[model samples]
Target: MASRKAITRSQAVKYRDASKAGKAAILDLVCAVTGFNRDYARRALRQALVPRVV
Candidate 1:
Protein backbone atom coordinates (compact mmCIF):
# COMPACT_ATOMS: atom_id res chain seq x y z
CA MET A 1 0.00 0.00 0.00
CA ALA A 2 1.11 3.56 -0.69
CA SER A 3 2.03 5.76 2.22
CA ARG A 4 -0.42 8.42 3.30
CA LYS A 5 0.68 11.98 2.59
CA ALA A 6 0.60 14.56 5.32
CA ILE A 7 -1.33 17.78 4.95
CA THR A 8 0.92 20.79 4.51
CA ARG A 9 0.49 24.24 6.03
CA SER A 10 -0.33 25.68 2.62
CA GLN A 11 -3.00 23.04 2.06
CA ALA A 12 -4.48 23.80 5.44
CA VAL A 13 -4.51 27.48 4.55
CA LYS A 14 -6.28 26.73 1.31
CA TYR A 15 -8.75 24.52 3.14
CA ARG A 16 -9.39 27.35 5.58
CA ASP A 17 -10.11 29.71 2.68
CA ALA A 18 -12.28 27.21 0.86
CA SER A 19 -14.44 26.56 3.90
CA LYS A 20 -17.13 29.07 3.10
CA ALA A 21 -19.67 26.63 4.43
CA GLY A 22 -20.48 26.18 8.10
CA LYS A 23 -18.00 24.67 10.55
CA ALA A 24 -19.58 21.22 10.27
CA ALA A 25 -19.13 21.14 6.52
CA ILE A 26 -15.60 22.42 6.80
CA LEU A 27 -14.70 19.71 9.25
CA ASP A 28 -16.38 17.09 7.10
CA LEU A 29 -14.53 18.16 3.99
CA VAL A 30 -11.22 18.42 5.74
CA CYS A 31 -11.52 14.98 7.27
CA ALA A 32 -12.80 13.46 4.04
CA VAL A 33 -10.08 14.84 1.81
CA THR A 34 -7.11 14.58 4.10
CA GLY A 35 -8.11 11.29 5.73
CA PHE A 36 -7.51 12.92 9.09
CA ASN A 37 -9.63 12.14 12.10
CA ARG A 38 -12.48 14.53 12.92
CA ASP A 39 -10.78 15.99 15.97
CA TYR A 40 -7.45 16.47 14.22
CA ALA A 41 -9.05 18.06 11.18
CA ARG A 42 -11.11 20.36 13.38
CA ARG A 43 -8.05 21.48 15.30
CA ALA A 44 -6.00 22.04 12.18
CA LEU A 45 -8.79 24.00 10.52
CA ARG A 46 -9.37 26.06 13.62
CA GLN A 47 -5.67 26.87 13.90
CA ALA A 48 -5.54 27.84 10.27
CA LEU A 49 -8.55 30.12 10.66
CA VAL A 50 -7.08 31.92 13.62
CA PRO A 51 -5.40 35.27 12.96
CA ARG A 52 -1.66 35.11 13.48
CA VAL A 53 -0.05 37.58 15.86
CA VAL A 54 2.64 39.56 14.13
Candidate 2:
Protein backbone atom coordinates (compact mmCIF):
# COMPACT_ATOMS: atom_id res chain seq x y z
CA MET A 1 0.00 0.00 0.00
CA ALA A 2 1.15 3.50 -0.78
CA SER A 3 1.54 6.05 1.97
CA ARG A 4 -0.56 9.19 1.75
CA LYS A 5 0.72 12.68 2.37
CA ALA A 6 -0.07 14.47 5.58
CA ILE A 7 -3.28 16.50 5.72
CA THR A 8 -2.78 20.19 4.93
CA ARG A 9 -3.70 23.04 7.29
CA SER A 10 -6.67 23.99 5.08
CA GLN A 11 -7.91 20.42 5.20
CA ALA A 12 -7.51 20.35 8.95
CA VAL A 13 -9.64 23.50 9.25
CA LYS A 14 -12.22 21.95 6.95
CA TYR A 15 -12.30 18.90 9.20
CA ARG A 16 -12.62 21.13 12.23
CA ASP A 17 -15.54 22.92 10.61
CA ALA A 18 -17.69 19.79 10.30
CA SER A 19 -21.20 20.01 11.80
CA LYS A 20 -21.64 18.96 15.42
CA ALA A 21 -23.44 15.74 14.39
CA GLY A 22 -20.97 15.14 11.58
CA LYS A 23 -18.02 15.82 13.85
CA ALA A 24 -19.19 13.29 16.39
CA ALA A 25 -19.62 10.72 13.64
CA ILE A 26 -16.09 11.45 12.40
CA LEU A 27 -14.61 11.22 15.88
CA ASP A 28 -16.19 7.79 16.23
CA LEU A 29 -14.75 6.77 12.87
CA VAL A 30 -11.28 7.97 13.87
CA CYS A 31 -11.41 6.18 17.20
CA ALA A 32 -12.54 2.94 15.55
CA VAL A 33 -9.90 3.12 12.85
CA THR A 34 -7.06 4.00 15.23
CA GLY A 35 -8.11 1.84 18.15
CA PHE A 36 -7.84 4.89 20.41
CA ASN A 37 -9.77 5.26 23.64
CA ARG A 38 -12.70 7.61 23.07
CA ASP A 39 -11.90 9.79 26.06
CA TYR A 40 -8.26 10.11 25.09
CA ALA A 41 -9.23 10.87 21.52
CA ARG A 42 -11.60 13.58 22.66
CA ARG A 43 -8.91 15.20 24.79
CA ALA A 44 -6.40 15.10 21.98
CA LEU A 45 -8.96 16.50 19.58
CA ARG A 46 -9.71 19.35 21.96
CA GLN A 47 -6.03 20.13 22.36
CA ALA A 48 -5.62 20.18 18.61
CA LEU A 49 -8.34 22.83 18.51
CA VAL A 50 -6.25 25.27 20.48
CA PRO A 51 -4.82 28.04 18.34
CA ARG A 52 -1.06 27.97 18.01
CA VAL A 53 -0.79 31.74 17.72
CA VAL A 54 -2.34 32.31 21.11
Write down the worst ten-residue block by lDDT for model 1.
1-10
Clashing pairs in 2: none
Best by TM-score: 2
Candidate 1 overall lDDT versus native: 0.61
Residue-wise lDDT of candidate 1 within 1-54, one digit each (tens)? 022234434456666566456556756765777788988876776675567899
Per-model TM-score, in order, reads 0.50, 0.53
* Candidate 2 minimal-lDDT segment of 10 residues: 1-10
For residue 54, give model 2's deviation from the true position in Å.
Answer: 14
lDDT of 2 by residue, 1-54 (tens): 011112122224544788888767766765665565668655556555567784
In model 1, which regions exceed 4 Å deviation? 1-21, 50-54
Summed over model 1, clashes come to 0
lDDT of 1 at 6: 43
